[model samples]
Target chain A: MFNDFINQFWPSTVDGLAFGSIYALIALGYTMVYGVLRLINFAHSEVFMIGTFGAMFVPFVLGINSALTGLALVGVIVLMILAGMLASAGTAVALERIAYRPLRRRGASRLAALISAIGASIFLQELFALIVIPNVFDRPQQGRIQMALPQIMERTDLFSIAGHPVKLHQVVVVVAAVGMMIVLDRLVNGTKIGRGIRATAQNPEAAVLMGVNIDSVVRMTFLIGGGMAGVAGALYLIAYENTNYYIGFLFGIKAFTAAVLGGIGNLRGALVGGVTLGLVENYGAIFFGSDWKHVISFTILVLVLMFRPTGILGESLQQARA
Target chain B: MALALGLAACGNGGSETTPADGGSNAAAPGTVKIGFMGDLTGANAGIVIPPRNGAKLAIDQYNKTNPAVKIELVEYDSQADPSKAVALAQQAIKTDKIVGLVGPAFSGESAQVGPVLEEAKLPSISASATNVKLAENGWKYWHRVLPNDGVQGPGIADFIAGGAAAKNVFVIDDKSEYGKPLADAVRAQLATKGVKVTNDSLDPAESDFSSVANKVAAAKPDAIFFGGYYAAGGNLLKQLRDKNVDAKFLSGDGSLDKGLIEGAGADNAEGALIGCPCYIATPDVTDAKVKGFADAYKAAYNADPAIYASEGFDAATVFIEAVKAGKTTPEDINQFISTVDIAGVSKQVKFAPNGEVEAKDIYIYQVKGGAITLLGKAAEAKLG
Candidate 1:
């Protein structure tokens, strides 16, 4: 088992980091929503899923079939990222207005909000599977089958790290994800809107007392969080080269686990948790075979929660602001 | 709440109208209703659609030739779900009063729906459900045109271990109802043939196979046999090639399609082999009946018949012949099918005591220049 781990160390680590970046981006959404509303926001997965379709739509609209190189390729990538972010942010806002807002106005319990989110998730999934994809997209034949994403860039090795070839796509995914995380971190810590978000999350009653406009802050949080998930969705499609209606469910669950592992409400903790979970699962597959990968991931989650309920980074919203 | 109520009302309306429509169709004289069940819009759609089309073509030809007995085909898309297949079977039996059924298409769905059809005494023929255990179920009404995995698995193992001359073989499966049993049978055959075999299983839902690819690289097997559908199979093949493992890749009928080439990329998929029980309608096929069906299929569907198209055509032809002999009731059709022997497009159609095809044969195909080329029968290939 150790021998297997030793042989596969570098390649597995590279793969783990590439996938870990995606988890971190999605984990931010779960963490942010939980920080403010203390609601699980199960529908956030659908937000990420819609972003994938949005990204695909951009390429379809551009009439791009073959690979585009150089500046043109860069332009398409940027356009897809923007489209994905806009679509997902729009979806998140609409979900809040339609589902959560009505329930919130009636002073509904957190459990009610959670159930509503679950219903929204299921509704969005079936909507895509049954109606939108078949009727609107005119792809009645590709129902439930994962549609292949056009390969915009060739998967050429950039350089060798310890005899393991690192591909260009992997580098792009990690750099883009880390850059987005940094920008988000600065936004939450630096801007006035960021301060309002932090205030609302800390204490909604006190934030309303301080004229923070808690509702706007909450909506903004959702928008920002959803935008990150959108970016993750685009990156995921580029890396895996496929998209489907059901992609969000597994990814969302994994990202949710990452958020909890890093301390559910902490921003930095989500990043830490995501990367660590990715690396652990990959290494565990090496030691225990690939079939046990999910088992090892969930076992680590159970063990972490049992030992240190607060998680590795610990839930510290105020400390994060400092 | 209004939306929910409206949806409920729509559902009620649909159920009410279905039986009424079915009742009228059943009451129509000189009309023989044939039920076809398959995955039209799910994971197995790639494999199921061609067979479904073939069945449709056969029924169209039969109706044109024998105008007195108008055969009406009622298709139900089970979407590869067993529960949906069972429901479709019930609807065919209780509502449509179908004289025969063409398929439950997938193995898992067939296994679940088989007993139901058996209980109803409805004669059914499947084009692609090739699980060996399906035949062992002792369902008097259920029959399959394609040879089971028991015949194909050993043939595949023989090709890999002898024809390709790979001493060390690695067997992988998606752990599906179809894939696992086929992989197990192939592994057993390979071991019996004095070949070293390593067994591995993958979840079909997983998109990445880099971990498994690395494991394969470490094992250093000379040949890899995958028992799964095209999606996972193609991804695994690509990942394995990326790691520079120059092993001969082999798979079953599940991975036999243009989809595999598209998924694995043309370069990586070159020279891979797929063993299928279905007949490859090569230009060399001299059977006049097979030629006629192929010509009709090409004209009808605007493409060459795929792997199971001939089998599907043959299955429908068998049922049509039985219906023409004045077998109107379910039991009459079942009784006619049990002892009937007819020459089909693929082979001589005759069922053994266990509801399996009497004469089993496997065809080996190679991916050459981005197309599947028939490399003759598996038995003709020299075995070590």
Candidate 2:
């Protein structure tokens, strides 16, 4: 088993990173929301689900049944990503304005907010599962069928490690993820809006006293975070080539685990935790069999919590200024 | 003596009028109740609803024509839960007093409800539950319309070993109650044939299967057999194909839907082999009765019948035959169903001593031209 793990290390790492990148992207939403609102956005996973539908609708509506190449491919992929971002960001804002805002105005407890978040999550999942699939999409007969996305990019062998070739899509997913992370990192650290977000995370009351609009800051946080999850959704479609209503269920749990593991409010920590979780699951599956994959992920989460409650990178989003 | 006789008569009248007053109003004179129970609104509802519709269709047709001994079809939704199934089974036997039962749809539920129905001596014929251990329970009242998973696992495995002649096979399951046992049966059969079989499993709830897909690629097996339903099976197939694994892909009846094609994308799913014990009535079947049933089902449901629809119809037909033979009580129905021998829409309906169907044929299906097409029985299909 050890020798087999050694032989398949490179391919597993590549696979792990691609998935880890997605987890990291999603973790951003959870960490960002928790940082600002002090409420875990359990419904953020559904936001990703909505983005996947948005990305899928691009090819379906465009009548692009066949694969595109060259500049056209890049243009369409950009459009798809933009659609995803718009949909997710819009959803996050609406969820705040419609669901969370009312409760916050009524001075509801955090437990109430958590329940509302979970309720919203189920409502969205079922809305897609029952109403959306049979009523709007193709194949009305199979209500729970996973809708296949049209091939956006032609996956060709880019390179091989240890005689196992890597597909172009795998490389694209990792590159796109890193690029998004860099863009997010630069935006949060280099801009005035970034400072405003960091200031709020440090102390919402103090930032308000310093004349920062806490409401706008929270909205912006959700927007930026939801947008990241949206791109992850698009990349997930490219990687998996399938979409369903409940696709977000397990993914939501994993991303939340990633966020907590990386230090709940830290941007860089989410990335590290996601990639680490992904790599550990792959390696653990290889060494101990795939059944232990979940056990391994949760074990890492528990160990991190027990030993270092503040997480691997040690600080929340406040550390950006520190 | 006259007062005692009056009291006994009043007691009998009081017992009969309660059920007469409260529902079961249809139980007038010569009518009796039959049951159809399964998951009508849960995850396996997709699997159960087809059979439920088929059984309903059969009884509707029977009631319309026969008119002598009227049969009212009662439905109880178990949602594929075993505890619920046991409870529903009790209600069907004691409250509704149904003479025969069509299903508890899934294997786990069937196992739970089997003894309940047996204890009541209510004749039952499951339309879809294909667990082989179900037949080993020694329940005289419990029977199934189709072949067991034991027949299905070895039927495709036999083809894989002889027809495909694959030396190395990779067996995978979603670790579901349905998939795991079917996969085990396939692996066991392949082992007996001296085939090198690699085994693995995937979490059914998670769509991502890249890690497992990579393992399949590295193993470099001659073919890959996955024992799971279509949704997860399709994603795995899509992933394996994306990596250009190129090995032959085969799955059991659980993956025999066109949803498999939609999930894997038609291009990736092409040449995939699927097996099912249920038979569909194609356009070429010359049997007027088969075509009539198909036409009737389509007209009634306004959709093409899916897997196990015919078997459900067959199970209902068995009970209808007993009712037509003037068997009204559960004991009489049980005795009548034991000798049941007729041509069903799915296949020949004949029961062995152990309550499994005698005519058990596993049909081979292939994905060709972006559609699932029947390639005849698995024993004969040279998919290699």
Candidate 3:
């Protein structure tokens, strides 16, 4: 058993970290929205989904088929990421304006807003499934089959760690996700708008009294969070090489769990939670078979909440610095 | 005694009233309604949609030839869900009042819908549902054009052990109702032949199979048999090849699809063997009927028939022949279908007492140059 554990450790860790990076990027969206509005933006996952479709559609419209290579591949990747971010940010702002903004103007209860968020999530998913994707994108079978993305880069081994060959795509995913997170972290900590967001999250009424435009700050938080999720979506296509309408549901739930596990309103906590969840799930699969991987991940969440409810970082929005 | 007689009279009156209403109904005397059910809008759409098209083509051909007796095909999409299949079966029997049915294309859906249609006395000939247990249910109304997995699995095992001369084999399944039982049957057959066999299962939703691929490479098997659909099978094959596991890959009919080559890439999919009961109308096939059917299919759908399209055409042909032979009532159709023997495009269609195809055979297909090439019939391909 010990030998088995030792042998599977490095490779599982590599797989876990690569997957975890994606989770972290998605979790940042949940964490930031919770920080400002004290509302769980359930539709954020759909925002990520729209980002992936945007990434695929932009290249397709530009006539970038499988033949792209070298510098052209790099240019396409950057363009895809930018397109994904723009689409996701646009969706997030629209959702805020349409769904959450009405509830806010009406001074509705938080529960009503949360339910509205859920409605938005389902509406977006079905819209893509039934109407928008099939008509606008001309993918009549979009919802039914897993659409294979154009393989932009050849899957070549970058290097081996402990006899395990790490592919170049995996490296790309991890680097891009981590780099985006670092940039987000700095922006949140070092900017004037960042201070406004921090103040609003700490005490919304107080921030309003202090002449901070609370609505703009909230919208900005959603835009930034949705942008991170969009980058994650682009990276996910490069990593998994497939996408469908329902892809967001599973990834969304997992990212939400990561947000909760990392201390819901804490930025750094979300990252730690994601990486930990991924590592735990991978190692658990090794010990208890791959079939029980999901069970183990969710069980870990229950165990964590049972012990330390605030999660690993154990700090809420008002308590933690940016 | 008076109450029982009164109840019987009411029941008799009710039975007489329905047929009287149905006789004068929108369906004229020469019109025969047949219901076709399958997953037209779900994960299995790629497999089921072709068959639906084939059924349509067969109906068109029948209508063109026989102008007097018109066959109207009432179609239902089950979405591959069991509850939905049951609802659709109920609708076909009660609402549509169909005398014959074409499919519940997947095994799981067929299993749920079979007994319901059987109780209604509606004869259904499935194009692709090949679970062996479906035939064993003793449901007299159910029939299949394709041979069950029981025959196909052993045929695959024999091809691997004898024709391919593989010493050791790894059997993997997706833990689905269709995949798991088929893998078990293959493993049992392989073990009976004194060949070494290893077993594993995978989640179909998972895209990454690197760990599983590495484990397979370490095992050093001579061949690998995956009993699953194309999506996971293609990913697994690609990962296995990437890990330098140069084992021969064999799979059941579920993986015999153009999507397999598309997913795994033509380079990775080359030389993989697929065992299927349905015949592939390769370009070189000289059977005039099959060649005609293939040409007509290409002209109609603008592509060659996928795995089960010909089987679907054959199934519909069987029902159309029965209708032409003066089998109108559900019971009459069921009785006629039970003993059907016709030379279909895919096979000589004949059902045994167990509702299985009497002509038990499997075709061995090899992926060459991104296309499925028929090697030979499995029994003939086998070596001593």
Candidate 4:
């Protein structure tokens, strides 16, 4: 009986870890932006959605008509990945400038940021829905853009331990996320700009007195956070290979949950919280049956919040300011 | 919030003139409205929109030649939420001037909306809702264009276990009334066939399913059958691959949406099967006019026209046939519809005494190369 239960536990743990990687990547954006601005960027999910749209649009832009030689196809796909990332990064910058920057400038409360995010989310979703795509085929096109590429976007053999198949997308999500986190860690902890960000996050009035360009730090934070979310979005579409107007809402909430679970303002907490939440939720489904999985994830989040109101790693707003 | 309510209230006020389902004056009312109720914004939009488009194309073409009776379509987005469907049905009956109703798209909505139409004595037909409990509820007004899941569940069981020789099957449901009951029906049928079934139920609201996949994959069942709509099912299929599970997947018509394959990622979902209630087998639908309808539908809608659209067209066609047969009063139309049998898209459309499709194909399709290729097309169970 115990052996059966143990067998179930291990597989669920692996499932959780794979999903956690994606959650962690997206959660980083939420945590970092919150850390700097003390405001939750609600349109972050729509940014993710736009990133997905970017990935879907990229392959079509490459003009790879059919299965080219494997090497050539790889080159095109690589170009697509770079183009998609750039597009997502560009979108993030625009969102920061257009939607968030003005609010920060006006010294709007966090509620204003929340409302702007909601408005931005609706705008992006409707934009995609109503946007007319130029048809190469004479047929009337659906709102979605289907790229002519290999249907299977992820390779399944890399992390296969013994005989188990490791999803190529999972590996990409984890590696890219870790690499981005490390770069972010360096930017925040080791650079002059990092000091400006910390100074702004610590005390806006004092930071201004200290001659810190708070605006640049805020813009830079959004740029970095948006870039990470863009990568996450591109990775999701590449892995899932479908784009829709509202798909981001589901993953967005999960990522937010991960952000809160980890101690919202802490970068490392976002990573730890994301991966931990993913594994816990996935394992919860496994042990209690699939139906109760979500109940379990939320229950754990509630429990964690009850015990440590600041989250497992998140500092309270006061502590962060201090 | 009040503005939103006011907007809805304004929309409701306009639909107040919607015709009662059964009124005394059925004599040559120059135009007939087919009321539509289904999700426009939420999850069921994928299923509802395509069929609505298909029905519109059929109505437009039909109206061009047959000037005596023109079909006007009135729509309400139920968001695949049942309570919303009831409110929409009430509006359709009271304000939209509809002679017959075309849809509520989903079974749960149909179940709730069905009784209201019965109370009104309105002859309404479901375009896609396939739950058996719907027809068995003793509602005189409710009818379905497609056969029920009671027939579909066993047919799927026969195909997967008996024909495909799948030894072990894992079944999961979204825990909604439609999803759970259908999953239960399939499990019972599989048990009858002496097949081993492992079953689980999950909340439909939860999008992630890595844990479920992990637990199910450990058993290594030959196929996974999810009796739920596309939203949760699509995520499940994706997460299963993410968790490295390679088992074949089979699901009911609830999962039969273009989004399912797109959302799940086409390559990973290869060899995944869907059990659909109605499909137009080209050879069987030999009429050039019907073929023309299919072409017109595919041209107007980017995706292939679903069987539900054909069924919606059939339901509309049934009303047309009934109108042509009699004095065009409610009693005459009702009697005419009960007796007539007409060959339309999907099958020869005939209703039982309880208002269900008498003969039809409930097919199993495999998603090979991102297209739904039909496997075994079985006739609807002739209930004893």
Quote the positional error of residue B216 for candidate 1 in Å: 1.9
Candidate 1 lDDT score relative to the true structure: 0.83
**Candidate 3 clash figure, as a count:** 0
**Could you estimate the TM-score for every candidate?**
0.93, 0.90, 0.91, 0.84
The segments of candidate 1 whose C-alpha lies over 4 angstroms from its true place after superposition are A134-138, A316-319, B1-27, B282-287, B381-384
What level of docking quality does candidate 1 show?
medium
Model 2 residue B219 lDDT? 90
Query: What are the per-model numbers of colliding residue pairs?
Result: 0, 0, 0, 10
Using lDDT as the measure, which candidate wins?
2
Clashing pairs in 3: none
lDDT of 2 by residue, B192-300 (tens): 9999999888897887787788788779998999998887888889888988899989999878777678778888899998888988765456789888888888888
lDDT of 2 by residue, A174-286 (tens): 99989999999998899988889999988988999999998899889989998998999988987787888878888899999998888889999999989998898898888
Interface RMSD after interface superposition, each candidate? 3.2, 5.7, 5.9, 5.5
Which candidate number has the best DockQ? 1
Give the lDDT of residue A202 in candidate 1: 89
Preferred candidate (TM-score higher): 1 or 2? 1
Tens-digit per-residue lDDT, A22-87, candidate 1: 999999999998888888899999999998888877887777767678999889888888888998
Pick by DockQ: 1 or 4, better one: 1
Residue A27 Cα positional deviation in candidate 3, in Å, after optimal superposition: 1.6
